[model samples]
Target: MKCILFVFGIIALLLCATVQAVDKSACSQPHEIGPCRKADPKFFYNSEKKACEDFLYGGCKGNDNRFDTKEECEKTCL
Candidate 1:
């Protein structure tokens, strides 16, 4: 019973991990907008379109445009 419960818990955790909540306006920096691609300018992830249409409409700006990695982008952009 304990082993089965442990396995189930692990599976549940993995399933939860797989579920990613898309952020429409994840980027908050004014300068760093270039790097981060607009959430869904043309393509819509799943069924819901990105909330921040402006972000997508305008090209990446400032630091966002410069960094490659998310962390780097955040640091530079945000």
Candidate 2:
């Protein structure tokens, strides 16, 4: 049981590390407006354009790629 618990702990640590990495690397992600129906303006880094672009946020369920302002997006992702 102790060995199994140790393995589980290691797996949990790995998962946490992966999540943290993804969060930190949000700038690389594509724009995701998500699946809601509210029109809120937002900015996201466009990797292909190598610039921040504006998009209409649905106000929910979007990824961390979103920023409230163009300056903030440029600061974070550019």
Task: State which candidate has the highest TM-score.
Answer: 2
Which stretch of 10 consecutive residues in model 2 shows the poorest summed lDDT? 16-25
lDDT (Cα, tens digit) per residue for candidate 1, span 25-51: 334423233455554332112113212
Candidate 1 residues lying further than 4 Å off, grouped into runs, are 21-78
Cα deviation of 19, candidate 1, in Å: 0.8
RMSD of each: 10.8, 5.5
lDDT of each: 0.39, 0.88
Task: Give model 1's clash tally.
Answer: 10
User: Which pairs in model 1 have colliding backbones?
Assistant: 31-62, 32-63, 32-64, 33-60, 33-61, 34-60, 34-61, 34-65, 35-64, 35-65
Best candidate (score: lDDT):
2
How many residue pairs clash in each candidate at the backbone level?
A: 10, 0
